[model samples]
Target: MGYMPTEMELIELGQNINMNLGGRVDFEDFVELMAPKLLAETAGMIGVKELKDAFKEFDMDGDGEITTEELRQAMNKLMGEHMSRREIDAIVKEADDNGDGTVDFEEFVRMMSR
Candidate 1:
């Protein structure tokens, strides 16, 4: 197996993607705001279809609206393959506000929202 990645690995990977996106947000809106970064992050690892597929988890009420937990699960699923459980936990804990032992949807969206 390949060597496990460190905390800096994920952080650095995200930073790299942000840099590769090559511009700042032009709009002040949330959807428009994070569009670029989100696309960039999901480009190689996740994608539009994959996001839509994963979004199912976010629809907590099943009213077609995405919640925070669903979002977190999507992200965890995306990058989880690239890192070890310990590393994933450390990275996730930084964003898990409820301390529920795992990331919830809202907290996840908030983290990505940052």
Candidate 2:
């Protein structure tokens, strides 16, 4: 799915357009006001295939889920950054929606989408 702007984002966009165009916004004006924000948000987004690839990379053992250990190892190998065990645990905890001590594909997607 594409970037879903929040209600607050719409409100702010409207306010910005109003401020710049004196309460009148043509299609061009709206596009001009919205394009930058949309581009910035999408720039950070990975496509489904890319996300799946990333998940696979972290799931090192081909187990279809990413445990804290797997994540830590992936981080160390991929990013070359040695994170602490507590830090790794915290990352898994944040994305483990079912509190299962592991992150499955759906949970990983939800975490990344945020």
Candidate 3:
């Protein structure tokens, strides 16, 4: 069953863009890929207080920091219903200019801006 992306698979998947998922997914068979895992299945959402609060859910380390992994987790939770990993990664990269793997709260807030 397809599950958490391996580091290598993540790299390979990141190399190409899937237009269907809005240039986020690379899998030629995302449906087959996500089927058994049921990654795409969800009930619904209630309310999103703010983007920062949404981000905090994955900031396990706290310290007002959010890493790519954390961001991915959050993206999966908040945006999984709409976007794919590649799109999420691209958006995350916009804020993580240093590519240090962490986005402080200030950076987090700044990055989500238009």
Candidate 4:
């Protein structure tokens, strides 16, 4: 891992980014500010095969895409965290670039890589 940022550092970065954006921090703004650091720290840490495996784990029913129900079940089973439908919907919204209401392999890869 390359220089994982401390909590304080992350707070400071978020504050700075928020200030730069006129006190408004949208999702894109947040992602733009943090993506570089995140990419740097995780670069080469995960390979394509691992990503595929992860995607498959979430993509229950071998459907080639992760539906909200699949994600919810996966989270509950794998992480023991019972997430609400709204929470799962928000996650899918963030990762589903195609707006198909599901996370495909490519979208999952992009989300993880980011």
Query: What TM-score, over all chains together, does every model reach?
Result: 0.33, 0.61, 0.42, 0.61
TM-score, candidate 4, is 0.61
lDDT tens readout by residue for model 4, 1-114:
235678997898878876798777888877667666665445446765778788889988998999999999999999999999999999999999789999987678668866
The prediction achieving the highest lDDT against the true structure is 2
Give, for candidate 4, the lowest lDDT window spanning 10 residues: 35-44
lDDT-wise, the better of 1 and 4 is: 4
Model 4 Cα shift for residue 50 (angstroms): 0.7
Residues 15-114 of candidate 3 have per-residue lDDT tens digits of 5345335566544466444432232221112123565565578687776877666776766676674456676577667877467667765455444442
Model 4: pairs clashing at backbone N, Cα or C within 3 Å:
none
Q: What is the TM-score (0 to 1) of candidate 3?
A: 0.42
Q: For model 1, what is the alpha-carbon lDDT of residue 59?
A: 52
Off by over 4 Å in 3: 1-52, 82-85
**Candidate 4: where is the Cα deviation over 4 Å?**
1-45
Pairs in steric clash, model 3: 24-87
Query: Model 1, clash count?
Result: 5
lDDT per residue as tens, model 1, 17-67: 567545333334334434444545544344446555444554555555443
Which residue runs of candidate 2 sit more than 4 Å off their true CA positions? 1-45
